[model samples]
Target: MALVTTTEMFKKAYDGGYAIGAFNVNNMEIVQGITEACKEENSPVILQVSKGARSYASHTYLMKLVEAAVMDCPDIPIALHLDHGPDFETCKSCIDGGFTSVMIDASSRPFEENIEITKQVVDYAHKYGVVVEAELGTLAGIEDDVVVSAEDSSYTRPEEVEEFVRRTGCDSLAIAIGTSHGAFKFKPGTKPQLRFDVLRECEKKLPGFPIVLHGASSVPQEYVHMINTYGGAMKDAIGVPEDQLREAARSAVCKINIDSDLRLAMTGSVRKHLVECPADFDPRQYLKPARANIKELVRHKIVNVLGCSGKAL
Candidate 1:
């Protein structure tokens, strides 16, 4: 009915063996497409905003758009969250500005510093009945403000997870097992496989705790082909496989972040549309199909990947 925290949703998902899709939103069409699909699927969803998104569309406009989505879909639960919040000020801003959840990502910092900052955010967010998500290990690839090289990316140490959760009191933890950010997640010859051994070890360390996977987009080849077919140049842009993501969902992973896939779907579809309809000049004429494609992609994720369809109240 209204914006809510991920607490209850994560609890249910942890028990139900499904993950909630946390899709990044930067504009009206992106919000509309994601919510409409979640509405149709009867699934709980998270609409996350990055600092870049807030800067691009302005926080006021994005909040208003999410409010419109809440009005449009009154039956489903939607959590408005800040994705990859870089600092305490940003986290505080989001918490004060009506975000239901905010992630404090200090993974780039040292372990003690990460705990200190995350604890600060957790204390503030809990005071306002908002949830906090924190990151432990660093992820590779570029996405908005988050960028780490392959040499710097590290898998989350299972041994430290229990202590981190205990000290930080974060609602969930985003661990970098193997998933990287951006469209070009992996190199050409490398096999894409998550360190489930690492994941399971983390689970063992923190039983029943909600886990999050960032850079989880699949980078569907269908959309890639469409993009390349229509004069786009994205080479070797592979992502985490969908089946592996589904497997993760059936484990301790309760939230999966998706961004690049939506971008690809929208971009590829609109490119095809413009190429086919060279005479069309209206924004709606092109964005209509793009929005529709996003909706379908999200719906497919709900039904086939995340397995959260019909889980919303």
Candidate 2:
């Protein structure tokens, strides 16, 4: 089939008590690994591209890579999305460039300004048959070009969601509940808990509407250990507990964003492969394992965490 919008996927996820995985894609290996897993698991996926990813890998290359994935995995539904779009121009470019969905993240701005900016993008995107996702609260930590400190981050106000959605006309809303960007989501020696109270309130307000959670990667400690064993020193790299994410999926959270996990899986695999086989200088030799690791990680996520496995069929 062709690339689809998140509308139908989110609807199914909401009804099925699951969430669609929105994985970030920057290169061919990443795209291939994610799609292959989704295809095997029979789960729909949202392959998203960020502004920084567009800068690192040209937009055209990413588009063609996704296009190829569509051809390679024709059975499952796939949505090409612009993740964390900074402005209307970026969102417009993706909407016009064949992306099925786009996210306009204006959460850092004042509420009124955020609504205005999101509305502008929503107006333009809906005209092109593209769906728009908007963020209501800023997330902490670093993800590509998105950087917000812990102190600056705030939980999404449940009260503001109704008006924001009404005014912006976005297809989905990303809320910051405790999930932060990157691997170091919480400080060491602290229990990371998502504010389900806040989430519940939002659900009460926006019933039957699709909600999204950014910075939702559960940074598997196995990957962290693998990286450290292979000459890396990433300490205290904790993420949202898988159980908490599973609970959210059973609620109104219809989409969950995961990027750090993919990066950790690939980086750790490449590090281990190169360190063990120093004589192997070929790119494929190292990236082959990295790609496999990513595929396994995605598969685990589909079946265990997101609970969307076999939904595509």
Candidate 3:
């Protein structure tokens, strides 16, 4: 029950023909909810810590929480990952601080600069036996403090992926394939589509290499309704369709990022419980159900979206 790097997970996922769910972890309850679901499903999971996560929950607390998860679920294959590490210093710090996997997100910088930064991170991370994941194209949407509007988002050119992989020597590539960031990714009257053609082209160029999809959460309408019906106002909040995510997983895309759905699930339950039971003032009375809802949501993602149930040791 030790933490592992994404390299091993991606290799196994690439061979198994199913992607592992890389869920974002912000706090103790979120970590417990996700890892507990993983134990139930017998699926390997990645507990990704973003910059905001580190800031919100102190790095020491988050690390200790994951360590507690390892102790709690001794059989699950869990990896502590740094999601979207902005620069070499951040990536290096996470690697030094016990993160097994770190993503060098320089997609916002110039292409050559991005490569240079990613290369630097790779050199540093490899020294610590930490795996590095890099992004090729920019993803549009707001994730915590990072914000990229729709006009700025660009698809990853298939021609550049091969070169990016060669030049940077990143372990995995997180590519933008029409899946934007945030819950309200697509507008009310539009259907969200992942560019399978681009994925096919990348697979053609770099066979057997693991690919990653960001902002792939399918915002379940049931949760949305619960949130709205129970005093929350997330109207028309939609996400990438499950079929689209399933298609990616069946292909070379092996890591799917999901956060908003879990947030929605937890908030929906908490709001409902708060609205229906105004007399219940205890924090646990509300938080317990919220945690349970998040667990159910994670289990559903493993069984339905990722199809990774029973794969863990």
lDDT of each: 0.96, 0.95, 0.90
Model 3, CA-based lDDT: 0.90
TM-score of 2: 0.99
lDDT of 2 by residue, 81-158 (tens): 999999989998888889999999999999999999999999999888999999998899999889999889999999
lDDT of 1 by residue, 1-313 (tens): 7899999999999999999999999998999999999999999999999999999999999999999999999998999999999999999999999999999999999999999999999999999999999999999999998889999999999999999999999999999999999999988998899999999999999999999999999999999999999999998989999999999999999999999999999999999999999999999999999999999999999999999999996
- Total backbone clashes of candidate 1, pairs 3 or more residues apart or in separate chains: 0
Model 1 ranges off by over 4 Å: none
**lDDT by residue for model 3 (113-214), tens:** 999999999989898898889998888888886699989989998998898999998999999989877888899999788899999999998999999999
Candidate 3 colliding pairs: none
Q: Is candidate 2 or 3 superior in TM-score?
A: 2
TM-score of each: 0.99, 0.99, 0.98
Model 2: runs farther than 4 Å from truth?
none
